[model samples]
Target: MSTSVADYLLDRLRAWRVDQVFGYPGDGINGIIGAFGRADNDPKFIQSRHEEMSAFEAVGYAKFSGNLGVCLATSGPGAIHLLNGLYDAKLDHVPILAIVGQTDRSAMGGSYQQEVDLHSLFKDVASDYVHTVTVPEQLPNVLDRAIRTALSRKAPTALIIPNDVQELKYSPPGHEFKMVPSSLDLTWPQVIPDDTAVRRAAEVLNAGEKVAILVGQGARSASVEVQQVAERLGAGVAKALLGKDVLSDEIPYVTGSIGLLGTRPTYEMMRDCDTLLTVGSSFPYSQFLPALDQARAVQIDNDASLIGMRYPYEVNVVGDAAPTLQALLPLLDERADKSWQADIESKVARWWETMDSEAHVDADPINPMRLFSEASPRLPDDAIVIADSGSAADWYARLLRFRGHMRGSLSGTLASMGPGVPYAIGAKFAASDRPVIVFEGDGAMQMNGLAELITIARYWQEWTDPRLVIAVLHNNDLNQVTWELRAMGGSPTFIESQALPNVDYAGFARSLGLEALTVIVPDELGLAWDKALSADRPTVLDVHCDPNVPPIPPHATFEQASNAAQALLRGDAEAWGVVKQGVKTKVREIWPGSSS
Candidate 1:
């Protein structure tokens, strides 16, 4: 009995516990597609509407499950389509493996039909590792190495299998590839450093009276340790967007996100802090960081390359966040001064009050913020929320509150749109028992695959548990980009380019056999949410929202203010209205006698 190279590859995947492979079929790689049919129930093959969606779904799987996500594509254009999604995973530091089929080995360099130079094409995207299997003997070794590299580096890896090689009979190597089990450990051990580094970090942290702690996605598992350190030092906690779910709003001194889509309290904490401790996040926006002259910093990260790279730090603690915090706990002195923490809490309280008021602002078209404020509290205890890029992401970052075992993530780093729906589709399968909800913009839905509603419907045919919901912010424009233009001192004359034609998203979903609802008023929101949650199948809620609402940055510059004035002079009333609202909100936030 002999096994095909495809069989050996699939076997290695099963051994690595890859239960799902997302992709589409094409002419260049029919052999592996045949193997998929023979794979039976061991590893399910999910067919996506497009190759790009397949890769994005793989990224979603890796992000949500903390495991290596796998996707397959045929040669040439098919393999090229995976780049955008692969870059999404690469930039976000999630582990994902891309298996691409190639034209026959005999077709090299002669411009054969559908042939591509995959090796050079994937080099930059899969900088961590990329290899092509030239022979049957190389099949198992190449597949194993690709997976290991993706896991160890927390990045994307590519394996190119030529069409001819996939159908060849597999032969046992005369000598087996060396296996170093310890080197390939996937347990994610919390690597701690020697006492000297911890002591140095503790010294810097203990010296400052006004300490602030900023957490990122990498510190998600260290929630308890993070809270303990913040409590002992009486420090204020602020989160990066990726770490929004790291600490809930229940923590008194915890300010929300920090940056353009951030809260005022977080901006104030970052600006006023004398000492800063950053955990596991390499947040790229340097403007939001505290000034070097004002603050001394201690940075904790497992990747030494990232330590002190974003800011000037007095101590670089190269270790896992949880154990490093645990080791540094004893070296800190308890600060008796409670003034800094108290001030931050007061600001945070007021910030929340302003947020509540803004969420309910009266407008002809429903305000988008109201959906998050009113619907978030009603979500299932174990809901997995995914937000698309654009205004939906801006609102979700600031307005949605995560509590009690709930988890959430967006297309961080790349900030790419169109992944919201596919991510939710992937998450629903990854956490089958938990409910999955998506907040998507109308532009993003049209850009990605609105037809993917068919994919969800296809999968739902096999499952009895109803567990997917999509909430579409049905504003007929790319509102986020429009705001960015206005903030950057540009005229809104070209706003017409970002506008989208009115499409009935709920009707489209209903056509696919999924339950659907459309609402135009704030009062209909709750019942629509209720119906979506209780339905026995996938559901979509299309809520019309005012596109004039601006995603105001935490701080605005003089030039930006001038830009808004210029637009208003040019008869751009929408820009004038949004900027007016922004100014009004800022006044309320800073005025001494104003309520939250």
Candidate 2:
């Protein structure tokens, strides 16, 4: 059997069981894109509005589906656009394969138009595996290596095929490309630590009176095992942002999140713990973690190099989260005392009260926190939510309570904006039967490449249940950066730089042939959510939010207070209002029995 290199590549992808490919067309990659069209039903080629969104949608697909994600792009700028999302997948440890186009082999070293060294450009991002196929014969081995390396290493891999080479005749020596078995699905092997390491970890955990567990995306598949360990040790669980859905917020022992966007329960749990058990989280914030001198620690991770990279640990169990915990569970003595856990639960209760007060505040304009809390219940139990960076993240991280089968994520390490809408679109493709929801700030909604909502509209009818919802928090301001300036003792000057022109997102969605709604009142948000979810196709809900409300830190430092005071002195009305409101709320909480 004989085939062109481009068709052979698609055949190998089919052999690897890759069902979807996201990308944009360009002159350099016209041959490959044409091959995609001719490859029968091997893979669904999703046309994104921009190459950046194509890459981001691929990242989202890998994140939600737990499978290999593939995206394509033409030479030069088209290939360059994939770096951001590829880096996101690399940093987050997701498997993705980028099939990039290249200038013709004949133009090598001549610097033809649109000729850029993609190999050199992708060197750092796709460090694990980066290669190009200069000839037809090299395609088979390189394709196998790229896809296998991406799946096994859980990172992004790149294959740059020249334009002329993509159309070259290809016939392998022994095996025919089309006859290769597509039934064998490759999966990463489950690694378990040795008995000695497991015993040492259990011993360290057993010695401490107060144990706290910090989990990340690495521990996602081990929820049951993590909960069992937490329960047996009477430990409090604090999840990293990437691991938000690992344990539901309603779980009495599970603190919502860790870091600045973390809950008070998580902060207190880490601050007072005698022992810390880290499971698959390389949380970057050292300040948010337990001090090295304060707590003895045990760390479990599949990557041995990342075990003690974040913090010092007495025992390092280098293995998969679930398997390691499964081996260590029987070696531990169940904790008999419950005082520490009870104290943490009490603090969580009070934190909920504070959050509720913030979420249901009666203001003329809707509070963003209130929007998240009120609208959360209306979301489907199994909904996959993606929150964009900025103030919207502050609200989503602090408010949305994951229960039942619900899950959510954001750009954890990249922390980039503009991926929310693309992420939701990618997740919809991964979980076509479930409702896919996104919470993005107006600033992000207007950012470059978010027009891929039109891509969703294009393929809306292909889905089993395309219940995709885009909920935009319309404050017309870069609320997070403004709050940061105030918190850092700087005057909120040059307000023009932070302000956004009002966008009628509902109208925008409607114009794109999707159901849409706009609401200014807080009470009306629930109905908007209901309408969005009930609609058969995609929907967008734009809620007018109060710009005056601040996303106060979970545990404010003295310097933060001083900065707020300085901002107030600088005639910042929002800052002054925040301080006054915060003080009054604290007073009421501290003195509930007082007559005054």
TM-score of each: 0.96, 0.95
lDDT of each: 0.84, 0.85
**Tens digits of lDDT, candidate 1, 165-238:** 99899774554465322222356566787789999989899889899999999899899999899988989998
Error of 2 at 595 (Å): 14
Number of clashing pairs per prediction, in order: 0, 0
Q: Pick the candidate with the highest lDDT.
A: 2
TM-score of 2: 0.95
In candidate 1, position 313 carries an lDDT of: 88
Candidate 2 residues lying further than 4 Å off, grouped into runs, are: 173-187, 448-450, 573-596
* lDDT of candidate 2 over 355-403, digit per residue (tens): 7766665544777887788777787889998899998888888888888
In candidate 1, how many Å is residue 551 off?
A: 1.3
RMSD of each: 2.4, 2.9
